[model samples]
Target: MEFRILTESSDWQGIIGEIWRFKGAPNDRNNPILPSYWQFLQIRLPELPETPIPKLATLSWFLREEQKRDWVDHRLVSIDPTLHVFSPTTEQVVFFWHGRNPSQGVIHPDFGEPGGSPWYDERPRLPRLRVEPSVVSNPSPGHLMPRPAFSPALTSAPGQVRKPKALSIILPYHNDPSHLFVPLQPFPDTRHTQTKTFQFPSRYYPLRFSQSNPNHEPILTNDTNEAWPASELEGLWLGSYGPHGTEVLYLHSPEECRINAWKVTGDVNVPRGVITWRFHSRYQTGPECIPPAAGLDSLPESCRIFKGSAHVCGTGFIPALESWIDCIVVVFDRDDIKVYWESLRHTSRYRRYKGRDISLETVPNESDSGIRVPPVWD
Candidate 1:
């Protein structure tokens, strides 16, 4: 009844990648250093009872899935579909975006009228599913979809638990985290040999993605920041901040009032899983929306600014000198977004991340050096 863990990176280069479970780091943790993204990333399965969810036996099944030949043999690292939905518990890492704040009662665009009313609690609640061993015809690889009728691995109990706890999804850009709240359409492809043998229905829904919202046109207003919705900046974005080079970020709006930026990959100072910055409307009506002409000339003439705060920390996040600095988001249409940290006194640009094709292509032939084989756990 536990959801297993895998390396944040899907690569096979040494110990940077390995499959693990709920237990903490192995003793002698120095051997295989866990990826920096680990702290910010964890997946949980639903407590729903009716779903024909099978116990995903960890190691032996992974070995059986391996068609042994060479250590260099390349294989597509497919994510376990069951790990998509994130059930946030009190013991788990509480994300700022997951706060129980009042939302504007928005719904996914695809859900239409029948997609049901917004949850009374005003948080995202993916539909409880009734899954069957089915194949997705021309499914978008790695896309999470749901059409009220079913989900991939978990099923809903009829008239019992009406609203399952909504989950935060983890999408990796080569170990850099990303999340999207599009729509969940069930496309279970239980076709793998071992999966078929064990009757494990595939939950990895392959989705067609768009790096840019070609159809979206922002509407500017005075009182309401209607231009800034959860879906407005909802995708993988690449941005640069001072010495931290270019890092990946995932943007989600927990409520209409704020857009939370979760770091997927970042510098030694800030690291992943932290809220790098978020946008709020308090300063939008003030003089702050008018961009300071100093270094922000690159932004288009048509830009709207929403004020926010940036997270600052020391190297390795030491001393807890964390400061919430003032910042602003310049929304020059949907495709082009920029940020200026007043305290850091710097400006940066952002764009949608068009994903790259990667393979977890290699594992060390000898186990003596890199990562010592972890002892079997209960």
Candidate 2:
């Protein structure tokens, strides 16, 4: 993940956001992502100290906690090109802050263990940001203004849109590392550093996370009340893409009887944002069934199967070189989603995306996953 500069002022403060690059797979799409500020912080951290850090915006900040999270996830997981697997991460971001010196016994222990110590034994700890209510803010000219790379995801809840604004949120500062500052900018300004030093893994600092929109509905199209069993698969899934890597795919059953496989992440051959393959429930009829490819087992005996057409394209995805190929699909629980392309004589496997990196809330009425709760970080 990288933050690209969108605009600038006298210093590193200006419009900025993160971008995810595109990687291709076997079944590719036409959308080649160049630069995308996919989201803007509904609530932002107080800026870290200003510096020459290109991707790392330098500014001072104060942390706060919000009883409610109006935030969303904006993260990307890079699958190993050969291993065909994604690295798993915990929902928490941990780092060290404040001084590491041992505690003193001057103050009352009622406040904390070693109330006398200015810093809590100073070790790595999990940080949470909570935006307090009653904290309205005005945009500051000295700080970086955030702009969405694309349009920011702004719905605090499904069907209810929330507007982005400068918030004077406070991160409660305890006697130790916690800090609560008003006006929403980093405390103790450091933009005037004369040394001009540039280094990383700084003495001790922090890590970050961007939660997916807890409220945005992600159902492709739910026209019917009782969706097909495939509707249970209506979330993020990863499809195998040969040696290039494992590309991200989203399976949504629309029109009640058909399943459409759309590329959430793809490589150059099939970039992303287009349907790779889809099948109608009506076509899986008749007694004769085709055998599986890619050395996969033939019988789950009771799983649903479908015959479909897989979309294909050349290396660069030239419009004229695009065509559809015969393919078969398999749905064997959440762990095994498979697709076999007869033209390539290969079968691609899919599974529930392990990357909790990013995702919007599943559509409420369109899905049956139960009430989705945002991770409790703040």
Candidate 3:
């Protein structure tokens, strides 16, 4: 079957907000705007399949200039249900966290147990380079470098007899050419017994300073540095680094981490209010624990460590929403996740109305609690 690509304008802010709320953002007194420890990508498949297991080939995100493309191989990890109990929509959404399977295609009987470990691998295994040198216009600014033309040969893995269909998507960017999400630097070399803490000004948020709004002021005014307790950094954190920023931080453990940073359009300093921390450890397993590296490679066999200088935005911060879009495109076998997709796609309003609401609602005197109410006219 030919590969099919479905594109949509992702409500990333709203989605992040919903996930934050699901993780107890309202009751979080410390940092209400802070996101939880776990982060997820909700995929709405084009068509539902009959089988329970959805066949996803790959998932990719068209990011800012520097790290032009971020791709994940399904063979490395599979998408599973989100840790949180709440979802914004009635669409039977399936949440998938970030991590890799150490066993490499091996299925665990428990499945839910920490079946596979997580590791970062920057090896150039794919047929095409994530950052194509041929299409790069300006070598100075990484993000502005154009992506190389796509070909079916580039998409297929080496030695695979059957080739999957190829689909190329062109994502639009409205912000300045030089400003892009700063790519995470390579993890510093360290011995197994050593514990190193590296700190740098994060370029997660677009630099948008307003002389009027004090709330818009950056936490890192100068080159000031702050030491964060590893224990305190357990949950998800949503904050900006630049003058204007939108970024997600997922700290599964002291060793494992995942981040989603973007230079979005508009004066929105940080999505869903200011930078804050949301604690949701109950919903997450610690970062994938990888065994120690024995040989030359410091990291495990399939893992790669990322640690480097933080990124910063270039000039030209546009306030138009139509200028850019946050999108995630997945190439999966048509059959994978079909049943779940169909259930969500075809869910009836009446059935949703009949169902009880399990989301937490804040009351005047009472603490935030999950309130179940029948669907009705406001």
Most lDDT-accurate candidate: 1
* Tens-digit lDDT string for candidate 2 (146-190): 322221111010111221211122122112221112111122222
**Per TM-score, what order, best first?**
1, 2, 3
| Model 3, position 37: C-alpha lDDT score | 16
Tens digit of per-residue lDDT, candidate 3, span 241-360:
322232433322333232222212112222221111222212221113212221122322221222211221111111221122211111011101000111112100100011113233
Q: How many residue pairs clash in each candidate?
A: 11, 37, 26
TM-score of candidate 3 to 2 decimals = 0.19
lDDT of 1 by residue, 118-161 (tens): 21224333434332222212212122222222222211111212
- The order by descending lDDT is 1, 2, 3
lDDT of 3: 0.20
Worst 10 residues of 2 by lDDT: 76-85
Candidate 3: C-alpha RMSD after superposition: 25.0
